[model samples]
Target: MKLYFINEYLGDIHNTGVEGMWVYAEITPSKNIDKFNDFFAALVDEENDFEEANFSEEWVDDNNWFVIDDENRKKGICIPAVYPDGVIAWRWR
Candidate 1:
């Protein structure tokens, strides 16, 4: 599954920085949303000791997660706090 980081500015798990910047996922033939969601949920769980306020570039890298660069199409996990909604896939012609 393709993970997306919706909000990068505001530090709110329930609220995204942008009005419509909700966590989104694009499931491909090789990707599974259920697995990704399960993994993400575990990380965000309070018992996991994950602190949204402590999220950082180094932290992401250490945790085997990454951000999306528009210029380059790379895949990696993103912050879970901003992902309050379901995955979205758009098709345009």
Candidate 2:
């Protein structure tokens, strides 16, 4: 899985920034795409909040993740950004 961080502003407040990160996983002949999608979807749904979200200590130590806004706490992460190709589905954080 390839991870990308897209920096963008959230909510009406100016100067407050957040990362809209996405994961891109290539499906190959040996890969089970359905299972992969289901796993990621469930994981995202379960740990949608920044405070409640779980990440590896190594990942956290290496990279900065999402920052939740007070107003958008209920919005959660893992919004799907669909593309025409259908293979490139983004899990927006």
Estimate, for each residue in 20-59, the C-alpha lDDT of model 1 and write its tens digit. 4344443232233343444455455666776545544443
Highest lDDT against the true fold, candidate: 1
**Prediction 1 global C-alpha lDDT:** 0.37
TM-score, prediction 2: 0.19
Error of 1 at 14 (Å): 16
Question: What TM-score against the true fold does each predicted structure earn?
Answer: 0.30, 0.19
Lowest summed lDDT window (length 10), candidate 1: 7-16
Residues 1-93, model 2: lDDT tens digits: 222222433212122223455544332212323323433344345446433234344323313323334554523334332222333333343
Clashing pairs in 1: 1-31, 13-81
> What are the lDDT figures for the candidates, one per model?
0.37, 0.33
